[model samples]
Target: MTYDTVAETDPAVARALEGERERQNGTLSMIASENHVSEAVMEAQSSELTNNYAEGYPGSRYYGGCRYADEVEQLAIDRAKELWGADHVNVQPHSGSQANMGVYLAVLDPGDKILSLDLTHGGHLSHGHPANFAGQVYDVEQYEVDPETGYLDYEGLRETAEEFDPDVVVSGYSAYPREVDFERIQAAADAVDAYHLADIAHITGLVAAGVHESPVGVADFVTGSTHKTIRAGRGGIIMTSDEYADAIDKAVFPGTQGGPAMHNVAGKAVGFGEALQPEFTEYAEQTVANAKALGERLRSHGLELVSGGTDNHLVLVDLRSSHPDTTGKDVEEALEEAGIVLNANTVPGETRSAFNPSGIRAGTPALTARGFGENACREVADLIVDVIDDPDDEAVVAAVGERVTELTDEYTLYE
Candidate 1:
């Protein structure tokens, strides 16, 4: 991981890269959407394939120097097909947001309707936020979780789908903690003649490892990020039945993106190969176990957990009930100061502004990647509660930061 060449060429950029490496090594990373990839994945991402311009699928590229590009992409696609049991997979999308766009372009007209969950209610912006292209180009309506229970109101969603009669129904979430029943969503979609898209961006590896219920066969289309629970390189993926294979491939290449990021495709191949190993299953189960342990310990300290607890790798904490005066951003900043990094998030019934929301979201994927188990996660939870209780207390922040340093040293990463 040394950057001596970069240091010789551009000291400023090299310093920033080194600083980021140091930050990741020194602190805890609890962001729900983030994970620590192995150095093998990193090397694949930094491979020489970055120069390739493979404008099309395997054996049919528009460019001549695409032999290796086709090989890497085909390997990634084959491995992903094995991992998720999809009939067809496209590994060229630059990000999860673009994967959603590819699906939208493949199926819907310019003004077709989209029915999805509200952004503040755990949905991604790509689902239909007003600022995103999906919102501007498509007619959008939203559903919500049950305010009391903090879980998806599937019955309500069905009712909404029947009334709205959307062209597409987007399921899956960014901040939610409960398991999604893709069958129920598919039933609602079937009732209304709408296509169902399950975006498993946060739980791709969990689903692949059989820790979470998969939506591959149930949902009409599935999309995911390669970097979240999967611990692959940073990229997006789209999976669909063979019936829509041609449509999706065209929509991804000339429709939404240009030449694929072949280097990232190489990384996906390596990471997917790693996921196929037996130890990855243990890693996936440990991720969820650590999350549950963290959530239970936080709840014991009087923090209100969304959906009561987690069924996956993340837990959403609604701070309004436990600490009315504290905002999620306050906790986020204090935790970062204590060397424990996570994010301020929007809760289901959000009363605060989006910038400084009413909840915090934490996950154990990155911690588990660093070899943390349930006991270590529980101790981290205790440290988090200490900071949340007295954010302004410099002594408490310093103590937690010290403990975090010790933990990070014990479970070293990226060495």
Candidate 2:
């Protein structure tokens, strides 16, 4: 992270860094799981915390000079616990995938069965993709979204859980548009005497900001990212019920990772602090407003939304019905060309490949935070629909791209 002496001779890196800043200023970042951290958080992340290893938690570190490190780590933990109302918080786990991995490691043996959401039907790769460790190390059973409604099949989940009798029942997703029925999932898990792990990585900010239901009180274990909707640094976080405290901490510390990233933890502390502020609540609310507005506008333009529209920060744009033969890859690349960035995602019953999916996933949290209101979100979605439905139209493309540049100018990133 050091560029202190690079400016003296390494002009190339400096130019590249400025180019990155320019990209942020111009491009519309619609990636659901991405956000730009604040200057305070960035400053803390690049601070002296990086200079120290501080292996081990708090005062029990192997390093001698870890008093301040302990302070920083504990500050993150306390603030996270307060924000999420959890019994225990581990600000380790590197990424959301690893956080869930540690949760599985804590309670389940290798080859133990876990009932989770299916990969293409809104589940995360970490939940149980065949290529991921979750699938290789554990017996992964899966549930799916309803084919007709494009929403959760609670009865299907219950039936699947009853049949599988898994050691753990996992709930959460990267593409689901509706609010999760955590209570129903919990009841099903309880019926089968299974533990429940809710991966709230995508909705952490919503939950923390009180826009969505908190999974902390209901799930036995909850895993999330400090980034994404949480809008913190790029790191995974693990929280547990008091009964599983020791096991969860051990799983995260020795079983999964050795040393914690103190710098990231410091950034997490700043993020948690920001979340505690009243304005962060306003930011979180505006994120949802922008999302709902964008979804409505897109659907009005004849675009099909999986589950109709989103109740949260992200929406998955189903393209097959809207623009025939329009792959998610084309939509993504085309949008990027116009300086609007969003990821290609899989829609329910996606017959296409995962590499180039059938849908585009977009969110408004970052752009909204950048000062795009509901009106701006609606306009952006209208332009997006235009670009996707008619990419070959040069004049339309140019006009939309110009609006994007003008919009960002009024709500600048670094300004």
Task: Please name the candidate that would achieve the greatest TM-score relative to the true structure.
Answer: 1
Task: Per model, state how many residue pairs clash.
Answer: 0, 0
> What lDDT tens digits, residue by residue, belong to model 2 across residues 1-415?
3354666678789778767888888999999988888888888888898889877898798888899899988999999999999999999888899899899999999899999998888999898889998889888899999999889999999999999999999998898988897888999999999999999999999999999977788889999989888777679999988899889889988999988888988999999999999998999999999999999999998899999999899999889886768899987887887889999998889989999889999998789779889998999998898899777777877888898899889888874
> Which RMSD values do the candidates have, in order?
0.6, 1.5
Instruction: Give all TM-scores, in the order shown.
Output: 0.99, 0.97
C-alpha local distance difference test of each model:
0.96, 0.89
Model 2 misplaced regions, further than 4 Å: 1-4
**Which stretches of model 1 miss by more than 4 angstroms?**
none
lDDT of 1 by residue, 93-197 (tens): 999999999999999999999999999999999999999999999999999999999899999999999999999999999999999999999999999999999
Q: State in Å the error of residue 275, model 1.
A: 0.5
For candidate 2, report its TM-score: 0.97
Backbone clashes in model 1, listed as residue pairs: none
